[model samples]
Target: MGWSLFRRSRIAPGLPVPGRCGPRRHALATERLLLFTPRTRLDVAAAIAASADAQAQGWLGTKADEVLPDPAVRRALLAWRPAGEDGRRIPRELAEPFTPGPDDPLLLVCVRRSDLGYAGALELQHLAGEMGGWLAPGCRGQGLGAELFRAGLELAHTHLGLATVRAGAETGNTASRRALARAGLVPDQGPRRHTLPDGRVVDAVWHRHDTATPAHCGDHQESPRRRPVTRSGSGHRTS
Candidate 1:
């Protein structure tokens, strides 16, 4: 519910304590945003509320529907209060600590650095090497999408130790495509027709950013022109 709840624990000065998610890996900060694992049910609720916006839902609602299929269930979720406030407690299963596997997709709650307000969420699917995210209505149209996605690229390459990251956008979604390009993803090949979680079929375009060298044919030696990019930093944090 607060930054303190997600604060890092250190074994000693300059020494981060390692947990199941890894040391100092639960939070990432950018020039304008902070991405971190959800620490409470409220964090997830905030994200749900953000994504429920009509405009955002058109592109992102399917996941929310799957997460809370029943309208009654969703209402209850949004209406639920923190423990001790209203004679109710969050369910144990929902409150249990999160321990994700190495290949699990990373989901980070996004907050604005300027106001510490809930912005939205970012996700990176490791096996697919893809990323996607949405923003709250209040945070949209201010050019933060690119920053949000750049943070995704940072998470993939710098924090998660990924060689490449890819993203897809509906061909007509100029805003999203522009943001992906601004985030340093170059247009790449992918299926022209793609199905959304909501079952809509749409024209899609893929983009990717690669730090790895392209594979060569058999018996071919590496060429200087194809050298992998050298990258190093800890600007992005993760869990």
Candidate 2:
């Protein structure tokens, strides 16, 4: 799971349309975490730090210095935004007030369960196509990663209309691979070398999932598809 937490910025192909599912904005809730919007910048930063710091262990291969906010780094990661809107491409809006179409599905995370002091999140960008997540080292275990994956998968299939889900890990990242295995994704074929900021080539293990496969094993005993996950009832939710 630790190695799986490593996330680098390599782009890949889009996923297929999901099979029949529900509309977007389905909210997921637990006693310790709440999945909705209006998250504070501090919370986002904390989660980001957890994610980047964990990846720095050389498993994800990113430098630990990359965790904090910098105008330059922001510019690079913020490219996910469209070109015209604000032109900055940074995440200006956490969640929109309007209903989501088939293309966009956003997710939020928070500490909710009474016993689990965990705070982390996962966002299925273009839930119909791409899926990415962030984890705080505090919330990395106790089965939270599997929960996050299930939440994202539900969004991908039910709302975004995506049939397949994709994710990647550093070549030797066993922790993340386990998380992916928990979710139901299998290694499609990777060990693909990607150039990093230092001009060094880093190998990665890319994985993929289809309707037949699951993203998490769920409750450890039930079928992967039978796992419990929170979903949005409305079209979407924002902070």
Candidate 3:
């Protein structure tokens, strides 16, 4: 899994909607994927469904007793839309867009350009300058993991305006570690042990990508400072 650690916070209702004030919703594109801030119930539902896959849940660590919506129902919800409605128009339920506070994590849904299908999700924690993401079962092991995480770096550095972005993975998850490295993140210092949301403990390794220029000894340029890594209950999976 390409999961990272961060404190979780609730997104309060009545926050200024996207495009009205604060940070506007973002959309990013890669050669094979389109990443966008979720704007509709369908978008949210699809992301949840992708994360609920049995293989993904293992690394993502879900509540043991929590029963998610039926897989069939989730797929049906993704296929539903208002009759004769423009596919591009925002629906009534999403009139008040989800807006995260400066410190809150923002989730961007990833879709395959070839079919516009739900491929996975990416999470960006603005305050911590870190990101984590996962791919759907159908999309994993297809070399999409590197692209998914590269998009995360773009979100943190280009869109979110962060100079440094970080990610962590269980030491034994070689696939995820390779994907992070391929996405330009290098090894960094962090806690050797991490607890997954499911309460399992494992050896952990951290990686980071920094866009800031290094400060010279005599120059007055101030290098970017690193933020302390913290554990959270949310987990992320990747190809």
Candidate 4:
């Protein structure tokens, strides 16, 4: 969703928590990408670039209107730590770890395995198990979108111990809706009004995924559902 406004300045970069879903060391491996739990300076740089890049901002609205009013504050928030903690665990005060407790959110960066480049981002929100993400321009339309969503599914269901997850998308963002469906999050009932980071209200469609059912991979029979009108509410930009 709105990856641009998610700043973690108060705490050090987070890694997977020790107990929730076994010992996962800051990384989730997909066939094409590696989703890192975000603990290094390099990761911080890639995440900021992917979120702040001109192309992604077009869809994710990376230019979040609130917070980050100062360039230095924004930079500090995105800046990674000095090198030398790749495999080691360094302690810091944390607001959210990968496997969050109630009221915590998890943020992970998607990286292309071949080139080790940032491809996109995914977020699991505070205690509720809702998810949202985006892919870079170069990574779009290459069937990587489904992979990104699948990585999110693995994190939320297998890693974070959530039984189901919900995601929402703007009406016109068909690519995002496609990815969500491919990841097994099918159409579920919900309202249509969604608020953008810029504060504009737009019609959106909602989808849900349950861990009990497996996603039908390579199935192109389904597309996002078009729903009726409803009351407006604040939500993430999934597409």
Error of 4 at 80 (Å): 12
> In model 1, which range of ten residues has the least summed lDDT?
230-239
lDDT of 1 by residue, 25-87 (tens): 455555677777666666576666666655665665355444444455544544543221245
**How far does residue 6 in candidate 4 sit from its true spot (Å)?**
30
Give the winner by lDDT: 2 or 3. Answer: 3
| TM-score of structure candidate 3 | 0.72
Between 1 and 3, whose lDDT is larger?
A: 3
**How do the residues 3-58 of candidate 4 rate in per-residue lDDT, one tens digit apiece?**
22333331123432212222223346566766765655455444555556444555
Full candidate order by lDDT, most accurate first: 3, 1, 4, 2
lDDT of 2 by residue, 49-69 (tens): 444542433443344465553
- Candidate order by decreasing TM-score: 3, 1, 4, 2
Cα distance off (Å), candidate 2, residue 198 = 6.7
- How many clashes would you count in candidate 2? 31
Off by over 4 Å in 2: 1-26, 30-33, 54-66, 69-107, 115-118, 196-200, 212-239
On residues 1-239, what C-alpha lDDT tens digit does candidate 3 reach at each position?
11122111211122111112123366566667767777665566667777776766766665665425477865644443322122545456634445544445778787775656678788876556667888776788888889888878876665555677778787777777888988888998877888776788878888889987422222111113335545442223443
Query: How well does each candidate superpose onto the true structure, as a TM-score?
Result: 0.67, 0.53, 0.72, 0.64
List clashing residue pairs in candidate 3: none
Who is ahead in lDDT, 3 or 4?
3
Error of 3 at 175 (Å): 2.2
Candidate 4 regions off by >4 Å?
A: 1-26, 63-104, 213-235
Those runs of model 1 whose alpha carbons end farther than 4 Å from true positions after fitting are 1-25, 61-64, 67-103, 213-239
